[model samples]
Target: MKKLVVLLSLTVILSACSAQASTNKDSNKDDKEKVSQSSEKKQTSSDVYVPNPQLTDDRSLLEIGQAFKDDKGVSSLKAIKKVNETYRIGDVELIIHDVKVIEHTPSYSMIDYFHGFTHEETFDFVKANIEIKNTSDQPVYFSPIAILESSTGEHRDWEADIYLEELNGELAANGSKKGNVGFILDHSDKEVEWVKIFTSDLLNEEQKVTNKAQEITIEF
Candidate 1:
Protein backbone atom coordinates (compact mmCIF):
# COMPACT_ATOMS: atom_id res chain seq x y z
CA MET A 1 0.00 0.00 0.00
CA LYS A 2 2.84 2.44 0.74
CA LYS A 3 4.37 1.83 -2.66
CA LEU A 4 0.98 2.36 -4.35
CA VAL A 5 0.44 5.65 -2.53
CA VAL A 6 3.94 6.83 -3.50
CA LEU A 7 3.20 5.96 -7.13
CA LEU A 8 -0.07 7.90 -7.06
CA SER A 9 1.69 10.96 -5.58
CA LEU A 10 4.33 10.83 -8.32
CA THR A 11 1.59 10.61 -10.96
CA VAL A 12 -0.07 13.74 -9.56
CA ILE A 13 3.26 15.61 -9.53
CA LEU A 14 3.94 14.65 -13.15
CA SER A 15 0.46 15.76 -14.22
CA ALA A 16 0.87 19.12 -12.52
CA CYS A 17 4.23 19.63 -14.24
CA SER A 18 2.74 18.79 -17.63
CA ALA A 19 -0.14 21.23 -17.09
CA GLN A 20 2.26 24.01 -16.11
CA ALA A 21 4.37 23.42 -19.19
CA SER A 22 1.28 23.57 -21.43
CA THR A 23 0.18 26.85 -19.82
CA ASN A 24 3.65 28.34 -20.29
CA LYS A 25 3.63 27.43 -23.96
CA ASP A 26 0.25 29.06 -24.45
CA SER A 27 1.42 32.18 -22.63
CA ASN A 28 4.47 32.42 -24.82
CA LYS A 29 2.35 32.16 -27.94
CA ASP A 30 0.08 34.94 -26.69
CA ASP A 31 3.09 37.12 -25.94
CA LYS A 32 4.44 36.66 -29.44
CA GLU A 33 1.08 37.57 -30.98
CA LYS A 34 0.91 40.71 -28.85
CA VAL A 35 4.37 41.73 -29.97
CA SER A 36 3.45 41.16 -33.60
CA GLN A 37 0.32 43.27 -33.26
CA SER A 38 2.32 46.08 -31.66
CA SER A 39 4.83 46.05 -34.50
CA GLU A 40 2.03 46.16 -37.11
CA LYS A 41 0.40 49.13 -35.37
CA LYS A 42 3.64 51.06 -35.35
CA GLN A 43 4.20 50.37 -39.03
CA THR A 44 0.67 51.42 -39.95
CA SER A 45 0.97 54.70 -38.03
CA SER A 46 4.14 55.62 -39.88
CA ASP A 47 2.50 55.10 -43.28
CA VAL A 48 -0.25 57.66 -42.80
CA TYR A 49 0.25 61.19 -44.20
CA VAL A 50 -1.32 64.00 -42.21
CA PRO A 51 -1.78 67.60 -43.44
CA ASN A 52 -1.02 70.90 -41.75
CA PRO A 53 -3.98 72.86 -40.38
CA GLN A 54 -2.64 76.41 -40.89
CA LEU A 55 -1.69 75.86 -44.51
CA THR A 56 -4.73 73.80 -45.30
CA ASP A 57 -7.12 76.67 -44.65
CA ASP A 58 -5.20 79.17 -46.74
CA ARG A 59 -7.31 80.32 -49.71
CA SER A 60 -4.25 81.52 -51.57
CA LEU A 61 -3.31 77.97 -52.40
CA LEU A 62 -6.40 77.50 -54.57
CA GLU A 63 -5.52 80.62 -56.52
CA ILE A 64 -2.14 79.14 -57.45
CA GLY A 65 -3.94 77.26 -60.29
CA GLN A 66 -3.28 73.99 -62.01
CA ALA A 67 0.22 72.75 -62.69
CA PHE A 68 -0.33 72.44 -66.42
CA LYS A 69 -2.40 74.83 -68.47
CA ASP A 70 -3.07 73.98 -72.16
CA ASP A 71 -0.73 71.01 -71.63
CA LYS A 72 2.17 73.42 -70.90
CA GLY A 73 3.86 74.13 -67.55
CA VAL A 74 3.03 77.65 -66.33
CA SER A 75 5.85 78.25 -63.83
CA SER A 76 8.96 79.51 -65.58
CA LEU A 77 11.50 77.48 -63.67
CA LYS A 78 15.12 78.72 -63.76
CA ALA A 79 18.32 76.65 -63.64
CA ILE A 80 18.47 73.13 -62.19
CA LYS A 81 21.20 72.05 -59.73
CA LYS A 82 22.02 68.87 -57.86
CA VAL A 83 21.41 68.32 -54.19
CA ASN A 84 23.39 70.58 -51.74
CA GLU A 85 23.93 73.21 -54.48
CA THR A 86 22.65 76.75 -54.00
CA TYR A 87 20.44 78.56 -56.55
CA ARG A 88 19.16 82.10 -56.63
CA ILE A 89 15.64 83.43 -57.20
CA GLY A 90 15.79 87.21 -57.26
CA ASP A 91 17.41 88.43 -54.00
CA VAL A 92 16.66 85.16 -52.19
CA GLU A 93 19.24 82.37 -52.05
CA LEU A 94 17.80 78.84 -51.84
CA ILE A 95 19.31 75.38 -51.58
CA ILE A 96 17.84 71.91 -51.68
CA HIS A 97 19.82 69.99 -49.10
CA ASP A 98 18.31 66.58 -49.73
CA VAL A 99 15.60 64.79 -51.71
CA LYS A 100 13.76 61.60 -50.80
CA VAL A 101 11.01 59.63 -52.47
CA ILE A 102 8.45 58.03 -50.16
CA GLU A 103 6.22 55.16 -51.18
CA HIS A 104 3.19 54.01 -49.24
CA THR A 105 3.12 50.27 -49.23
CA PRO A 106 -0.21 48.44 -49.07
CA SER A 107 -1.47 51.52 -50.98
CA TYR A 108 -3.02 53.55 -48.22
CA SER A 109 -5.09 56.70 -48.87
CA MET A 110 -7.49 58.82 -46.87
CA ILE A 111 -10.55 61.06 -46.95
CA ASP A 112 -10.12 64.18 -44.86
CA TYR A 113 -13.58 64.21 -43.29
CA PHE A 114 -13.20 67.50 -41.45
CA HIS A 115 -11.68 69.48 -44.31
CA GLY A 116 -13.83 67.83 -47.01
CA PHE A 117 -10.77 66.98 -49.11
CA THR A 118 -10.49 63.53 -50.59
CA HIS A 119 -6.96 62.15 -50.73
CA GLU A 120 -8.27 58.71 -51.58
CA GLU A 121 -6.11 58.28 -54.66
CA THR A 122 -2.95 56.26 -54.21
CA PHE A 123 0.07 58.53 -54.84
CA ASP A 124 3.75 58.93 -54.09
CA PHE A 125 5.62 62.01 -52.85
CA VAL A 126 9.03 63.53 -53.44
CA LYS A 127 10.12 65.45 -50.39
CA ALA A 128 12.82 68.14 -50.54
CA ASN A 129 14.64 69.68 -47.61
CA ILE A 130 15.09 73.35 -48.41
CA GLU A 131 16.83 76.40 -46.95
CA ILE A 132 15.72 79.93 -47.84
CA LYS A 133 17.79 83.04 -47.10
CA ASN A 134 16.93 86.67 -47.68
CA THR A 135 20.04 88.29 -49.14
CA SER A 136 18.49 91.71 -49.81
CA ASP A 137 18.08 94.52 -47.27
CA GLN A 138 14.29 94.47 -47.51
CA PRO A 139 12.10 91.86 -45.92
CA VAL A 140 10.72 89.31 -48.39
CA TYR A 141 7.86 86.86 -48.10
CA PHE A 142 8.55 83.21 -48.94
CA SER A 143 5.79 81.06 -50.43
CA PRO A 144 6.20 77.32 -50.21
CA ILE A 145 4.82 76.96 -53.70
CA ALA A 146 6.88 74.74 -55.99
CA ILE A 147 6.85 71.87 -58.45
CA LEU A 148 8.70 68.61 -59.01
CA GLU A 149 9.74 68.06 -62.60
CA SER A 150 10.44 64.51 -63.68
CA SER A 151 12.95 63.63 -66.37
CA THR A 152 10.03 62.67 -68.60
CA GLY A 153 8.65 66.22 -68.46
CA GLU A 154 6.02 65.53 -65.82
CA HIS A 155 5.29 68.42 -63.44
CA ARG A 156 3.99 67.81 -59.92
CA ASP A 157 3.03 70.65 -57.61
CA TRP A 158 3.85 71.29 -53.99
CA GLU A 159 1.45 69.33 -51.80
CA ALA A 160 0.45 70.91 -48.48
CA ASP A 161 1.02 68.40 -45.71
CA ILE A 162 2.30 68.38 -42.15
CA TYR A 163 5.89 67.94 -43.30
CA LEU A 164 5.57 71.02 -45.54
CA GLU A 165 5.22 73.55 -42.76
CA GLU A 166 4.25 77.24 -43.04
CA LEU A 167 6.93 79.16 -44.95
CA ASN A 168 4.30 81.60 -46.21
CA GLY A 169 4.98 84.54 -43.92
CA GLU A 170 7.71 87.20 -44.09
CA LEU A 171 11.41 86.76 -43.51
CA ALA A 172 13.41 89.59 -41.97
CA ALA A 173 16.26 91.28 -43.79
CA ASN A 174 19.23 88.89 -44.09
CA GLY A 175 17.24 86.25 -42.20
CA SER A 176 17.20 82.56 -43.07
CA LYS A 177 14.82 79.66 -42.48
CA LYS A 178 14.96 75.96 -43.26
CA GLY A 179 12.11 73.49 -43.85
CA ASN A 180 10.78 70.71 -46.11
CA VAL A 181 8.26 70.74 -48.95
CA GLY A 182 6.66 67.76 -50.70
CA PHE A 183 5.29 67.18 -54.21
CA ILE A 184 2.43 64.82 -54.87
CA LEU A 185 2.61 62.59 -57.91
CA ASP A 186 1.39 59.29 -59.19
CA HIS A 187 3.14 56.17 -57.90
CA SER A 188 5.81 56.15 -60.55
CA ASP A 189 8.41 53.59 -61.40
CA LYS A 190 10.58 56.33 -62.94
CA GLU A 191 13.02 58.56 -61.10
CA VAL A 192 12.75 62.33 -60.70
CA GLU A 193 15.43 64.30 -62.58
CA TRP A 194 14.89 67.65 -60.88
CA VAL A 195 12.78 69.77 -58.50
CA LYS A 196 11.71 73.43 -58.84
CA ILE A 197 10.93 75.54 -55.75
CA PHE A 198 9.16 78.81 -56.49
CA THR A 199 8.52 81.75 -54.20
CA SER A 200 6.28 84.79 -54.65
CA ASP A 201 5.49 87.85 -52.55
CA LEU A 202 2.41 87.30 -50.42
CA LEU A 203 1.98 91.04 -49.92
CA ASN A 204 1.18 91.51 -53.59
CA GLU A 205 -2.01 89.54 -53.94
CA GLU A 206 -3.14 91.24 -57.16
CA GLN A 207 -0.18 90.16 -59.26
CA LYS A 208 0.02 86.44 -58.54
CA VAL A 209 2.55 85.61 -61.26
CA THR A 210 4.92 88.43 -62.10
CA ASN A 211 8.57 89.19 -62.90
CA LYS A 212 9.30 89.37 -59.15
CA ALA A 213 8.64 85.63 -58.94
CA GLN A 214 11.75 83.51 -58.49
CA GLU A 215 12.40 79.79 -58.87
CA ILE A 216 15.14 77.36 -57.75
CA THR A 217 15.57 74.05 -59.57
CA ILE A 218 17.19 71.07 -57.81
CA GLU A 219 18.42 68.18 -59.94
CA PHE A 220 18.71 64.67 -58.62
Candidate 2:
Protein backbone atom coordinates (compact mmCIF):
# COMPACT_ATOMS: atom_id res chain seq x y z
CA MET A 1 0.00 0.00 0.00
CA LYS A 2 2.78 2.46 0.78
CA LYS A 3 4.45 1.83 -2.63
CA LEU A 4 1.21 2.40 -4.54
CA VAL A 5 0.60 5.71 -2.71
CA VAL A 6 4.11 6.97 -3.62
CA LEU A 7 3.60 6.16 -7.29
CA LEU A 8 0.27 8.04 -7.35
CA SER A 9 1.82 11.18 -5.77
CA LEU A 10 4.69 11.26 -8.30
CA THR A 11 2.32 10.95 -11.26
CA VAL A 12 0.16 13.87 -9.98
CA ILE A 13 3.20 16.15 -9.59
CA LEU A 14 4.48 15.35 -13.07
CA SER A 15 1.13 16.09 -14.64
CA ALA A 16 0.87 19.48 -12.91
CA CYS A 17 4.37 20.47 -14.05
CA SER A 18 3.58 19.65 -17.65
CA ALA A 19 0.33 21.67 -17.56
CA GLN A 20 2.11 24.70 -16.11
CA ALA A 21 4.76 24.58 -18.78
CA SER A 22 2.18 24.54 -21.56
CA THR A 23 0.40 27.52 -20.06
CA ASN A 24 3.58 29.53 -19.91
CA LYS A 25 4.43 28.80 -23.51
CA ASP A 26 0.99 29.89 -24.70
CA SER A 27 1.20 33.12 -22.70
CA ASN A 28 4.60 33.99 -24.15
CA LYS A 29 3.34 33.46 -27.69
CA ASP A 30 0.41 35.80 -27.13
CA ASP A 31 2.69 38.49 -25.77
CA LYS A 32 4.94 38.26 -28.80
CA GLU A 33 1.98 38.59 -31.17
CA LYS A 34 0.85 41.75 -29.39
CA VAL A 35 4.32 43.25 -29.60
CA SER A 36 4.49 42.53 -33.33
CA GLN A 37 1.15 44.25 -33.94
CA SER A 38 2.27 47.34 -32.03
CA SER A 39 5.45 47.47 -34.07
CA GLU A 40 3.50 47.33 -37.34
CA LYS A 41 1.41 50.40 -36.44
CA LYS A 42 4.53 52.58 -36.31
CA GLN A 43 6.07 51.41 -39.58
CA THR A 44 4.75 54.12 -41.94
CA SER A 45 7.61 55.24 -44.15
CA SER A 46 8.43 58.81 -45.27
CA ASP A 47 6.62 58.37 -48.59
CA VAL A 48 3.31 57.64 -46.87
CA TYR A 49 1.88 60.83 -45.34
CA VAL A 50 0.17 61.35 -41.99
CA PRO A 51 -1.53 64.43 -40.57
CA ASN A 52 -0.95 65.95 -37.15
CA PRO A 53 -3.32 67.41 -34.60
CA GLN A 54 -1.18 69.20 -32.02
CA LEU A 55 -3.09 68.14 -28.95
CA THR A 56 -2.13 67.90 -25.29
CA ASP A 57 -4.01 66.75 -22.18
CA ASP A 58 -3.59 70.22 -20.71
CA ARG A 59 -5.64 71.88 -23.48
CA SER A 60 -7.35 69.35 -25.79
CA LEU A 61 -9.28 66.13 -26.29
CA LEU A 62 -8.75 64.05 -29.42
CA GLU A 63 -11.11 61.56 -31.09
CA ILE A 64 -10.87 59.89 -34.48
CA GLY A 65 -14.08 60.34 -36.53
CA GLN A 66 -14.37 56.69 -37.46
CA ALA A 67 -18.14 56.53 -36.98
CA PHE A 68 -18.96 59.09 -39.64
CA LYS A 69 -21.56 57.71 -42.05
CA ASP A 70 -19.50 58.11 -45.23
CA ASP A 71 -15.87 57.64 -44.21
CA LYS A 72 -14.04 55.35 -46.64
CA GLY A 73 -10.34 55.83 -46.02
CA VAL A 74 -8.23 54.02 -43.45
CA SER A 75 -7.72 57.28 -41.56
CA SER A 76 -9.64 59.92 -39.58
CA LEU A 77 -9.80 62.33 -42.51
CA LYS A 78 -11.45 59.68 -44.62
CA ALA A 79 -13.99 59.13 -41.87
CA ILE A 80 -14.75 62.84 -41.53
CA LYS A 81 -15.36 63.13 -45.26
CA LYS A 82 -17.74 60.20 -45.24
CA VAL A 83 -19.88 61.14 -42.24
CA ASN A 84 -21.06 64.50 -43.65
CA GLU A 85 -22.37 65.36 -40.18
CA THR A 86 -21.40 67.05 -36.95
CA TYR A 87 -20.85 66.17 -33.29
CA ARG A 88 -21.02 67.85 -29.90
CA ILE A 89 -17.95 68.81 -27.92
CA GLY A 90 -19.30 67.04 -24.85
CA ASP A 91 -22.79 66.18 -23.58
CA VAL A 92 -23.98 69.76 -23.93
CA GLU A 93 -25.15 69.12 -27.54
CA LEU A 94 -23.34 72.20 -28.84
CA ILE A 95 -23.23 70.94 -32.43
CA ILE A 96 -20.08 71.46 -34.51
CA HIS A 97 -21.03 70.50 -38.04
CA ASP A 98 -19.76 70.67 -41.62
CA VAL A 99 -16.25 69.55 -40.71
CA LYS A 100 -14.24 69.55 -43.96
CA VAL A 101 -10.60 68.65 -44.48
CA ILE A 102 -8.53 71.00 -46.63
CA GLU A 103 -5.66 69.67 -48.70
CA HIS A 104 -3.54 72.63 -47.57
CA THR A 105 -0.59 72.11 -45.28
CA PRO A 106 -1.51 72.30 -41.62
CA SER A 107 0.91 75.18 -41.11
CA TYR A 108 -1.18 77.52 -43.28
CA SER A 109 -4.78 76.25 -43.00
CA MET A 110 -6.32 79.05 -40.94
CA ILE A 111 -8.68 78.09 -38.13
CA ASP A 112 -10.30 79.74 -35.16
CA TYR A 113 -7.26 80.80 -33.12
CA PHE A 114 -7.01 82.29 -29.64
CA HIS A 115 -4.31 84.93 -29.65
CA GLY A 116 -2.33 84.69 -26.41
CA PHE A 117 0.66 86.84 -27.28
CA THR A 118 -1.06 90.22 -27.64
CA HIS A 119 -3.84 90.06 -25.02
CA GLU A 120 -2.79 87.79 -22.19
CA GLU A 121 -6.01 88.30 -20.24
CA THR A 122 -8.66 87.23 -22.77
CA PHE A 123 -7.30 84.05 -24.50
CA ASP A 124 -5.90 80.57 -24.19
CA PHE A 125 -2.18 79.80 -24.07
CA VAL A 126 -2.37 76.45 -25.87
CA LYS A 127 -1.92 76.29 -29.63
CA ALA A 128 -2.19 73.38 -32.08
CA ASN A 129 -0.58 72.79 -35.49
CA ILE A 130 -3.08 71.23 -37.92
CA GLU A 131 -1.57 69.45 -40.98
CA ILE A 132 -3.60 68.31 -44.01
CA LYS A 133 -2.45 66.43 -47.09
CA ASN A 134 -3.84 65.48 -50.50
CA THR A 135 -3.00 61.78 -50.89
CA SER A 136 -3.56 61.61 -54.67
CA ASP A 137 -1.56 61.44 -57.89
CA GLN A 138 -3.07 64.67 -59.27
CA PRO A 139 -3.43 68.04 -57.52
CA VAL A 140 -6.52 69.25 -55.63
CA TYR A 141 -7.52 72.03 -53.31
CA PHE A 142 -10.02 71.69 -50.44
CA SER A 143 -10.55 75.37 -50.10
CA PRO A 144 -11.81 76.92 -46.85
CA ILE A 145 -12.42 73.99 -44.58
CA ALA A 146 -15.78 74.88 -43.04
CA ILE A 147 -18.23 73.67 -40.35
CA LEU A 148 -21.78 74.57 -39.42
CA GLU A 149 -23.57 75.22 -36.12
CA SER A 150 -27.11 75.60 -34.76
CA SER A 151 -28.10 78.26 -32.25
CA THR A 152 -31.73 78.70 -31.14
CA GLY A 153 -32.47 76.01 -33.77
CA GLU A 154 -31.10 78.27 -36.49
CA HIS A 155 -28.52 76.93 -38.93
CA ARG A 156 -25.23 78.79 -39.31
CA ASP A 157 -21.90 78.16 -41.04
CA TRP A 158 -18.51 79.40 -39.86
CA GLU A 159 -14.82 79.42 -40.89
CA ALA A 160 -11.41 80.06 -39.38
CA ASP A 161 -10.07 83.56 -38.96
CA ILE A 162 -6.90 84.93 -40.49
CA TYR A 163 -5.66 88.30 -39.31
CA LEU A 164 -4.11 88.21 -42.76
CA GLU A 165 -7.20 87.84 -44.97
CA GLU A 166 -5.39 87.35 -48.27
CA LEU A 167 -4.31 83.95 -47.06
CA ASN A 168 -7.74 82.42 -47.78
CA GLY A 169 -6.87 80.57 -50.99
CA GLU A 170 -7.27 77.14 -52.60
CA LEU A 171 -5.02 74.09 -52.37
CA ALA A 172 -3.77 72.88 -55.74
CA ALA A 173 -5.50 69.90 -57.29
CA ASN A 174 -3.74 66.53 -56.72
CA GLY A 175 -1.18 68.25 -54.48
CA SER A 176 -1.10 68.89 -50.74
CA LYS A 177 -1.51 72.19 -48.86
CA LYS A 178 -0.23 73.37 -45.47
CA GLY A 179 -1.14 76.02 -42.90
CA ASN A 180 -0.54 77.06 -39.25
CA VAL A 181 -3.11 78.13 -36.65
CA GLY A 182 -3.06 78.34 -32.87
CA PHE A 183 -5.10 78.87 -29.70
CA ILE A 184 -4.11 80.22 -26.30
CA LEU A 185 -5.99 79.65 -23.04
CA ASP A 186 -5.29 81.41 -19.76
CA HIS A 187 -4.27 79.05 -17.01
CA SER A 188 -7.21 80.16 -14.88
CA ASP A 189 -9.85 78.94 -17.38
CA LYS A 190 -8.05 76.11 -19.12
CA GLU A 191 -10.88 73.58 -19.24
CA VAL A 192 -11.79 73.70 -22.96
CA GLU A 193 -12.84 70.47 -24.62
CA TRP A 194 -14.65 71.47 -27.85
CA VAL A 195 -14.20 74.40 -30.23
CA LYS A 196 -16.12 75.63 -33.33
CA ILE A 197 -14.30 76.49 -36.60
CA PHE A 198 -15.96 78.62 -39.28
CA THR A 199 -15.59 81.41 -41.84
CA SER A 200 -17.21 84.73 -40.98
CA ASP A 201 -17.08 88.34 -42.12
CA LEU A 202 -19.24 89.60 -39.27
CA LEU A 203 -16.45 91.03 -37.08
CA ASN A 204 -15.47 94.07 -39.21
CA GLU A 205 -17.80 93.88 -42.24
CA GLU A 206 -14.87 92.65 -44.28
CA GLN A 207 -16.78 89.34 -44.84
CA LYS A 208 -13.65 87.19 -44.70
CA VAL A 209 -13.03 83.71 -43.37
CA THR A 210 -12.88 83.81 -39.54
CA ASN A 211 -13.97 81.99 -36.40
CA LYS A 212 -16.78 82.46 -33.84
CA ALA A 213 -16.32 80.12 -30.92
CA GLN A 214 -17.58 79.41 -27.40
CA GLU A 215 -15.86 77.79 -24.46
CA ILE A 216 -17.36 74.58 -23.04
CA THR A 217 -15.68 73.10 -19.99
CA ILE A 218 -16.28 70.10 -17.76
CA GLU A 219 -16.52 72.17 -14.60
CA PHE A 220 -18.49 74.89 -16.36
Which structure among the candidates has the greatest lDDT? 1
What lDDT score belongs to each candidate, Candidate 1 first?
0.42, 0.25
Residue range 109-180, candidate 2, lDDT tens digits: 222232313333222222222323322333211222222222212122212222111112222222222233
| Model 1: lowest-lDDT 10 consecutive positions | 68-77
lDDT of 1 by residue, 11-95 (tens): 3233233334344443354344344444321122113223333122111112212121221112211222226656666666666
On the 0 to 100 scale, the lDDT of residue 120 in model 1 is 30
Residue runs of model 1 more than 4 Å from their true location after superposition: 1-82, 105-122, 152-154, 158-162, 199-211, 214-216
* Candidate 2, residue 133: how far the Cα is off, in Å: 2.8
Residue 33 Cα positional deviation in candidate 2, in Å, after optimal superposition: 36
TM-score, structure 1 vs. true: 0.46
CA lDDT, candidate 1, residue 26: 38
